[model samples]
Target: MRPQALLPWCLSLALAVPLVGLTPASARAATDYQAEDAVISQGTVATNHTGYTGTGFVDYTNVKGSYVEFSVSASAAGTSALTLRFANGTSTDRPMDLSVNGTVVASAVSFPATADWNTWATRTVDVPLTAGTNKIRATATTADGGPNLDRVSVAAAADTQAPTRPGQPSCSDIGEDGLTLAWGAATDNVGVTAYDLYEHGNKIAEAPGNATGKALTGLAPNTTYDLTVIARDAAGNTSPASLVVDCTTKPSSDTTPPTRPGTLAVSGVTANSADLSWGASTDDRAVTAYDIRSGTTVYQTVTSGTSATLTGLACDSPYTLNVVARDAAGNTSDQSNSVAFTTKACTTDGGVPSSIATLSTGWTIPWGTYWMPDGKTALVTERDDFRVWKVTKDGTRTQVGTVPNAVTTNGEGGLLGVAVDPKWDTNHHVYFMHTAAEGNRVVRMTYDGTTLSDYTVLLKGIKKNRYHNGGRLAFGPDGCLYVSTGEAQTPDLAQDKNSLNGKILRMTTDGKPAPGNPFGNYVYSYGHRNPQGLAFDRNGRLWEAEFGNSSKDELNLIKPGADYGWPTCEGSCNVAGMTNPKATWNVSEASPSGIAIVRNVVYMASLRGERLWRIPINGDNESVGTPTAYYVGTYGRLRTVTKVPGADQLWLSTTNCDNNGGAADGSDKLFRVTID
Candidate 1:
């Protein structure tokens, strides 16, 4: 006989007879059945279990293919909630497959372990059931078999609510051939399952409910499209359509390609990179991108521009770069004249010192360091203290004077970037970049070896932000002062040629634009994110180190009027009209701050990376070799590194007093480093 037939007569009589004035069994709520009351196919009844309602519970065999079956009755063919009570005394979970009638409803239903064997828990799942009597079976999936079987209950589930309407749709990444549309997520009473994308009234695409966007391709150029989105739930109910978004693709009318770019020229060749430029090309529509090709491979694609920096080349290697123009319709023009160039040969032996000697301690957030004409005395500027110090090789330091009219409102702004005049003995002029009440400015002061006076403001229009006030000052090979400025976190300013921010500015000692500036303005190079390091190689090539946002940190070779591709290309991207970095490091390894060239080697100081990177400069300063790290994590945070004049040593400053470093105030130090 079945296990149901073994139930006690007294309990069966109580279930058959309803209470006085109560409804009959057919009209009553759903019923629950204990595991032992059902047909136990392969399990033993355990009466020692506590917290169970029935006389006993089933403990299934710990072998493969163990199961318990329940005969259930439902009023109609619809959704029903199936709740199973069980206990897992073992440390591992026991999973089972649930089947209703003959169809599998849920797979791998987990029966997690409780506190003890006496503890019980319920796992409810929504399953479809047919009218009349049906069989519900729980079969073990693993050899360990199912958990201790307690009881199984069934209840009807009726869902009618639809998902909430999707948020307004927006379009982006619009191109001649494709575009992307995105919207906010929609919520549903039940779980959402999928979404449908509509173009006009017809459905064009479908996405998972969790997906918030979709990309549509194979689009006609110069065409406009109306797009909307609808969210669907697991029950087949869909929400109202999202707000329509209009997207227009780039136009493609004229098949005529741009005229072949001419006058290809290569400059600033380094060990691993070169700067290439050519005359602008003309097209019937408009030249959209220029493909810089090396042999058959496209080196870089620039947008609507005629120049780009070719990076990541091999040292002492020859390359032939050709320019090709393309229009909106993707028509390519004839290749321009090819230019051949060779990278410089490596100079250093590619080794870095494993140890450093302390020079001075207790400095506060030193931002810039420069060697004086005397070759033994060095000058250091503190970003937060707005003070300058004159230090000797033996670690003796003196407070020369405070920068006049300097103010510090943000963490990055204040007195920064100090440069000694190349003709310091005669002129005694020292230039500085500092923050004032108005903005960040450059000023010249007179230093007579002991004291500083005669402060004169030369240039003052560069925008300043709480952070990213790129204040690195140096005298270029042309004997003019070079200033690096940040975009003040304003992205568009990086692309604006007229903005002083997001550029490397070159000017005379009196603060006027340098005579050979490319744009007739102070701007030397534009599109810098937050460049802080500037060093000139033996070949007069200027190398810059910049802090990148999340993606990459860059080491750029500066060129006149060149765009370094800040907001457009973070590192080495294929975008057109922007110059790529010669070398890039992950942000964690190289938040590169200060750079110096010593013995034909580029030494970069990292703040967050807390290391010094040494890059070997090749012959003619054409390229650079692989970089090796030193003093990693041994030092707190390195801020600046400058070559000592007429010596084989470099001055390294620490910036542990600022917010990120977390070092105690007055705990920073200055080190004299010797690279072998």
Candidate 2:
């Protein structure tokens, strides 16, 4: 039977049917199976929301294919009513596929909102079941995942049989900290769910039900261990332990680091790329990797060979680099003698500066600028004062409103990044990213061409710090909102896919994870240190600008779900699974903040470089041409650069009033730069 929502009718039916299903004639005794007691995948038992039955409800992760399976039994083959209690707080419907015994009975079953998460409701569906054990599964069909599931009520029995003891386990490929453990599979009446490996009575590792082997790691070096395996079924039944196997880890004897690399030489130097080769280092056991360093910080790691290629280098730049050797034991050798080289000069495209005219003045650290759909006015955000202004194409400015609950980090965080919805003419919606009391947030506000109102938070929980609080937003050609976030000064967070910080997020206007996202979350790309600039080229491809740690700043062509290799690579690298930048500048030459595209050329504004970098997008749309600097040292700390909607010009803002500039309040000015 198709599922139907139960609200008032379910409450009355539950009170009136207390004794209705107590006999076999009435389809056996009705039993309530709590979702937390069932086998859950890609979900968690959560008590964050109230009004749930039993201990807690299953909070499914925001991803498709997440499910909760309940093993149930029946007295005979017959049709039974399955009543599932859930809570959906979102306005959008969360749909799931309901299956019985691995066969789908209902596809895309709608679970509508129950006002709020605390409010509970029910949906009943009738399905045929086998006399033996049957599995009832609800799998999410949308990226938003299933709603909070409380329990499933039906007349069914529970499985209680345990699996047989696992066969004797054997060890192989033993190492200093890990080993491979294999065992014979165990049988169960209902089927085994997993096999857990134990060491000294403590569970250490687990393998899937169909597997008889697992790799165990994190063991002590040169230590002997007594390990056994125990099989478990879906009903939480555990079998007797298998025969124990004793093993010893390899000794940690290698202590010497690899010899320093020899004869580091640079050859084939181009404007944007270089090739280097070095003598291989020797180690006591094995030299695992080689690190290429610029000054002191390592720029890239070479895992297999002594020759490497470095791309994305700035034109006409001088570089001093060294090499270090590393062994498998994590020991590092001293730096090799440095090699200094100067890249070839750039061939200028149509990127030469024509004229720069002051458009607006008396502003304080204008951090972001986005044009309105009408192309006659633009929205501008002040980083320190949290003020948003409306500016005309003719340089007329008006104080529209201030973002609420915006707190300053006293450094780079305050009110940053303003994006107008593509449908702003109809929705009057505008989005902003700012620092708050707890963290950073993306909020939506309403503007009716006169004032801003109706402040509402769309997304939050991005950590913020005094520095590295990357706040940049733009609307993609697909009508999705894109946000750039920093790692909050925590370098490791950049590499973590689960963290919202140090990520480029793509979401809907409602702040939901955009459809077709790679990780089934809001993260579009990860491993970014402080990505502050986001722009779309003529081909709708995304281009980004990021601040490097100490060595290089980067310009990247963004791709969904690609890893940019933060905390590991600074600029170009030879690492696998990590994307290299299209162009890179020395940290002193470009602490790029905001970027804009005009006529297939990307204009990057630099804070520390005090210059505007113009790089032409190659015809292939994958790489950038040689970069040329404009207005060097003329503008004090350039901050934001925005393309004029229908003109070959850019609206550039200065950040001279910021902490880095140390200028007086209202010292910042806005200028219009015409491309030749």
Which candidate has the highest lDDT of all? 2
Q: Report model 2's TM-score to 2 decimal places.
A: 0.52
Where is model 2 more than 4 Å wrong at Cα? Answer: 1-351
CA lDDT, every prediction? 0.80, 0.84
Give the Cα error of residue 384 in candidate 2, in Å: 1.1
| Candidate 2 residue lDDT tens string, 1-676 | 3223212221123233221111111124677999999999999999999989899999999899999999988766667788899999999899999999899998999999889999999998877788888999999999999999999998544444568879989999999888999999999976888987766433467899999999998776677887878788765556756777889988766768888888999999987678989998898888888888776555557898899987645566677889999875567787888889987876655444467899999999999999999999999999889999999998999999999999986567899999998788788999999999978999999999989999999788787766678899998877778999997755556776767888999877776776666777778999899999999876678999999876789999999999999978989999999999999998767889999988788999998878888888886458877776666566779999998988889999999998668899998999999876
Can you write out model 1's per-residue Cα lDDT over 95-120, one digit (the tens) per residue? 99999887888999999998888899
Clashing pairs in 2: none
Residue 470 lDDT, candidate 2, scale 0-100:
89
